[model samples]
Target: MTRLVVLSLCIGMVSAASVMSAASAAGPAPSGTAGMLFNHEHLNNGSPGWNETGVRLNYTLAPRHAFELAVARTERFDLRDRQLSALYVAPLSRELTGSLEANASSTHRVLARNAFGTTLQYEFAPAWLVHGGVKTTRYDTVRVNQALLMLEHYFSNFSWAVAWRPAHAFGTNANSAEVRASYYYGDKNTIGVILAGGKEAANIGNAVTLTDLRSAAVVGRHWLNREWALNYGIGSTRQGDFYVRNGMTLGVQYAF
Candidate 1:
């Protein structure tokens, strides 16, 4: 599933790292730097429904350098019609860091889900980061290749994150874990309180399809100007035969 379509666009941007969280004074930009982000998701995993669109590009290849590219498209309203994901990110260092990325995907009956797999990343601080990869998939799977780890923290108003994925036949699993608490009085408003649960299993070579799931999510953010910003979130996923009633995301970002 193209690594689940880049992990479902990383669950709608993962709070955009708290909107870049201040600290912006590393001058020299204007040699062609740009920013754009748009995301939409409305999934009703009952019978036939899913409409997803994602577009991202943040560019600057100079002073301190930068580059990111993401493309996603999903349309399934009558079953069978999918062109999943594409991504590329590069920014080697400015502090303990590293990067390398690639992914080409399609799978959810649209077929063809394997052709690219190359990911290696490392980051030390600023909420630390790490990823080790190799993904290739098909039916009757019993370990195409897998090893993934993700951890995130933004403490203060409270935050927590977790991910441990092993895909052979769902041997090692815990694909998600999140705990959150938030509050921001005014001027860049934010009010939140959320609790999440996780577990996902996909047995290789589908016995048709096998998956166990769990979920819970609620988040919100607002700042009408200074380059535009508004975010809304809702979540629910209880899988047995797949069911996620309400999940939403709307975002905009620009700062150059």
Candidate 2:
């Protein structure tokens, strides 16, 4: 569910990229709506180490729809079990928009959980975006379904977004929820922070467990040419005192 909602926002960012291009253009700038990037990172904060290099493509299908495809393989993560996703952006009105998406995987490793999901979005106001949806687990015994609601505002080159949701971790009726938000700043450089707390049920034992996570990220981008660019971000995740991981990514992209 979080994956889909974020993709919707990414779609919006792609559309806004075009709009920003228009706003910056003296005349008609080349109307190219697709941007592709190749990203790499050697990052490890607390969990299994991850060194990844992958490519991602983001583009528009129409004035109201967008699509994205990404494939990345870590040292331990399977290359065959990659990531691919799509989104349908709907505009309820000029300033209001909505979207739907599917985030799926080709294989479910031990590390894989909630590998597939569906999402929906509603933009009730210009300063706020609302969303709700659900997702389920892809493997055995464990059945986790999640629903979320989010609100966000965009101002100039920066924006803030926050959301809360109920997550049911199958095998029991107990449900838990979490709230998280991130803020970005600058024309291209950005920083973000997230705070989340929730609970979940164990699939095998049916025991309930509290889930709390904190995250912070720093990103930088540099455009070398009209069709070439670079992007990098570093972030850390704290999942209680038991599990923690730090991740970093860098990519060079060429768009046609």
Candidate 3:
């Protein structure tokens, strides 16, 4: 009965990535455009685990150029932290785009002290894109470096992507891979499934370590009207020798 309840809730909620990435993937809003997003998440592992609340603001300066600011509060394992993040996206050419992001935390007990990343996407062929990025994160005990390469293709209203991510931390290397499939129904409306597995480097309570990780999630966004939309994700994660987490996220976005 407990497992059934969790499954039901998962089916109704959204993924964390879906809520955050949906806006960026849809491209820049109109010039002088502004938007806001409110997000909440909960995770459990037999006991009360993590709860998070976040808000993000976005503005477009011109066509193909935009920036976003976000703030989040997280509570887990009796520790609380606040995080701030900023992102900028712009077009490099007709077939190329780039993004840069940076983030910092008020406390490093359960989060990274700071992190920075950049990514570039190029349309190499019709309906096909290639992406590459690198990131570095500073934690209380260790620094983690990571990189990713991905290929994506779109057909009709469906899209598929596969990505490889590699990381090094604590004098160890970890490799992870993921596959995603998405369906687009209307303007900025999408649903997707993501599956990922392998080893990952994570910061856990001031310690950075490598762990075997496996996860799956279903995520989506649905536009309620012209200016309002709903985002949701439901997922589970298994970390070897650590813990299993079942989580759900919900978010709302409004544009003006």
Clashes of each: 2, 4, 6
Query: Model 1, 184: alpha-carbon shift in Å?
Result: 34
lDDT of each: 0.42, 0.43, 0.66
> Higher-TM-score candidate among 2 and 3?
3
lDDT by residue for model 2 over 1-256, one digit each (tens)? Answer: 1111121111001112212111222222223334433333232432334444455565544444455555544343223245555544545555444555454545534323334544455546554455555655444455666665656555554555555556666444433333333333322333343444445432111222434545455555555766665666665655445445565556565655
If the candidates were sorted by their TM-score against the true structure, best first, what order would they fall in?
3, 2, 1
> Model 2, poorest ten-residue lDDT window?
3-12
| TM-score of each prediction | 0.24, 0.65, 0.84
Superposition TM-score, candidate 1 onto the true structure: 0.24
- Evaluated at residue 6, the lDDT of candidate 1 is 11
lDDT of 2: 0.43
Compute the lDDT of residue 153 as modeled in candidate 1: 47
